[model samples]
Target: MMNFEMPQFALAAPEIWLGVMVCVVLVADLFDRSGEARFAFWLTQLSLLAGVWLAFYTHWGDSGQTTFNGMVVSDSLAALLKAASAALAALTLAYSRDYLRDRGLLKGEFYLLALIATLGMFVMASASSLLVLYIGLELLSLSLYAMVALDRDNRVGSEAAMKYFILGALASGMLLYGMSMIYGATGSLLIGEIMLAASGGENALLLAFGMTFALVGVAFKFGAAPFHMWVPDVYQGAPTAVTAFLGSAPKIAALALFLRLLAEGLGDLQAQWQVMAIILAVGSLAAGNLFALVQTNFKRMLAYSTVSHIGFLFLGLVAGSEEGYSAALFYAISYGIMAAGAFGMIILLSHKGFEAEQIEDLNGLNDRHSGYALVMLLLMFSMTGIPGTVGFYAKWLVLQALVEAGLVWLAVLAVLFAVIGAFYYLRVLKAVYFERVENPQPLVSSRGPRVVVAANGALILLLGLFPDTLIALCRAAFGL
Candidate 1:
């Protein structure tokens, strides 16, 4: 019911800013056709920065305000998640700049695609109606499918593109069908109205079926178990920089959208979805961590690790409380930064013409470059949930929330899996500090990228040292 020219400036500011940015970047690309493409690239970064600011500024004082005829909203949780998405996207752009340029992918259009995708994620986070959620999901999903094949010449990249598109289409179909069923049951597509119908105890069977189908769609989008078959292949085959962006930024946004749709809007159905999430947690943890144990390719291993970490995030969600939600949000934000750094290291270490795809490549790393090896060590420990690292705290919060939810058995399982997870994480450390490879050159980074890497590592230490402030910020944002 909303038009493009609607007077919903307060609600539309983030999308409006991002839309203008897409146009500006495309037009600039026509003028800056120099082979280096550095100017256009930096310009795109600046524009994303503007979009980030617009997200915060427009939503600063608003909470629970449905705008544009019930399409978008500025709620306590939505605002926090949107800011997290922007932060993740901004970091992804900063860390991957050098990598993108090195791979001959220094295109302004790439940034445009990222911004548009990011905008869609925020809209999903703030969606009040099912129609808006589907539109936002597609906008984000379609952009990612194209971005996966950014390296047109790489056959693996093209293969990943096809797989992602075909699978994504199936997910969309399942989701839309579920939405139709829910609409038929409730006679409304607005999430608020559907909640009312569900509460009225009308069409209970239809509601359960619709919820199951919707769970499948969310699982597909989130790379959860059984639906996660495409992720490892996509990560392994895409350009490394694109993989970094895919792993960190888009995933963060998708989690936010999941919370918005499943938790906030469908809160009354917690018993239902919490069970589904627990199953997802167990499956993802088993598949991702165990599969990662045998993987030799470094990026693919990290891809599996990413899936296990998503499982842990779901652990917090199963608690079904405000503290659990906040903890999950914190974990999502911290994990995202760690992911960027881990992949950035891959990009940083690879010299031109080398893919840097093996765990063996990190051996004798300390002998070659003590500083870079140490950074890798820090990242590995954090991912493994070692103390004195943010990863530990993130895992601690989720476990604590699970215990509070009276799910001691699940917590015990988490502890056991964390132990299993430790082994793989240690392999990376063992390769770096203990073993030997024919590392011929020092792990050198350009000054700009070195700064980015150091900043990322410092954030891990800073948050690990004193997470009280950040946790307090999350509390404030969530209106706890």
Candidate 2:
């Protein structure tokens, strides 16, 4: 009989810990009647903290190993992303607690599903094979589908869930088909093996066809233009807390997916995929900015803004260099922080029965609470890529990558759309400070969310002031 080698389980400790904790939380919730929800909350937070420590441990000492027979890997990039995602998840739970408790949505199920989704992100970030990536993607998608409908009493929430489920299923099918085609062309399901096969220039036509479908699927997942039909509706319909979770951490996972599939697996096809990225990037910028100009709802506008941000993220990827890839990674991490803060502000301002959703809902925020209003201003500035904010540096780095790659024209077009996008973000600020509050209500008094939100805003400014550290870390992720 052939002997089997034992897998190196230590390399996968972070993911394994997360999986075990999620199960423990689920089982532990069963017997908790009076405090199930709150107990689940602290447990989830503790689990994430443990994950963060384990992720850092991997980054510092236990990397460069492909585990699970090449289905997953431990590397600096994956470790950093896992740590960041875990931190974001913990903060999201903190912001979500008051909102969920107030709305009778404080059930253990919400925390459980969110943790499951976080586990999916971890899987995607560490995936070394196409099959593993797709499994992670499905885990994430299905969890979010249920999350959108968490408020069963709200018909709009139900409608959004159905729409998301249907459209998400279609996207998943496209992605799987694309993966199959790539497997057919390259004769491998592993990304590293696919890269080797693709570099040989065999099955050219099949590779191109598979690449197209795969790019389409990536566009849909990123909510890029032409495939962004589901973003606005779901953001508008989902509870603000769920929206916050939906908007933030998964983005990092998506970026990891792109980097793995294109930059690593299909790097040899740069000439072919660059054009596709350009088209998607330009379309997303135009459609996202123009449409966001007319949106009155805060979350829907954010959804469109997300489209444009993804477009910017694509700029670096299109450049197809180590610096460009790292820049894209930096942008992804920065955007995740900005997005969580943006949606968290909505949760902070909302009350038991009142939703602070409408753009008008933020009118005269400064008059009601100047401190929170200032936080909103910083978040808006960062989202708009204003100077002295991390957003500005993020966009600037991507543009520099494009220019270095000799894509001057595309860079110019991106700047133009970015200017257009600035209008809506400025409009929100105007509502916060210049406009009048239609119905004044006290902001939430919970110190936890407030402190976290303030810290988030401060981070935008702090990172903007000193971006070298993050940029260096990102560069190191790619061994630059």
TM-score of each: 0.96, 0.97
Q: Candidate 1 lDDT, tens digit per residue, 267-315? A: 7777888888899989988998999999999999999998899888888
Highest lDDT: give the candidate number: 2
Point out where model 2 deviates above 4 Å: 60-63, 438-441
Instruction: Quantify all predictions' global Cα lDDT against the true fold.
Output: 0.82, 0.88
| lDDT per residue (tens digit) for residues 1-480 in model 2 | 978778888888888998999999998888788753867888899999899899878754345679788888888888877887888877777799888888988889888888888888888888889999999888888899999999989999999999999998998888888889999999999999999999999999999889888888888888888898999999899999998888888888788778888888999999999999989888888989999999999999999999999899999899999889998889988998899999999998888899989999999999899999998999999999998999999999999999999999989999999999999999999999999856666665689888989998899899989999989888888887
Positional deviation of 316 in candidate 1, in angstroms? 1.1
Regions of model 1 farther than 4 Å from truth: 1-6
In candidate 1 the C-alpha lDDT for residue 198 amounts to: 78
Clashes per candidate, residues 3 or more apart or on different chains: 0, 0
Instruction: Candidate 1: give its CA RMSD in angstroms.
Output: 2.0
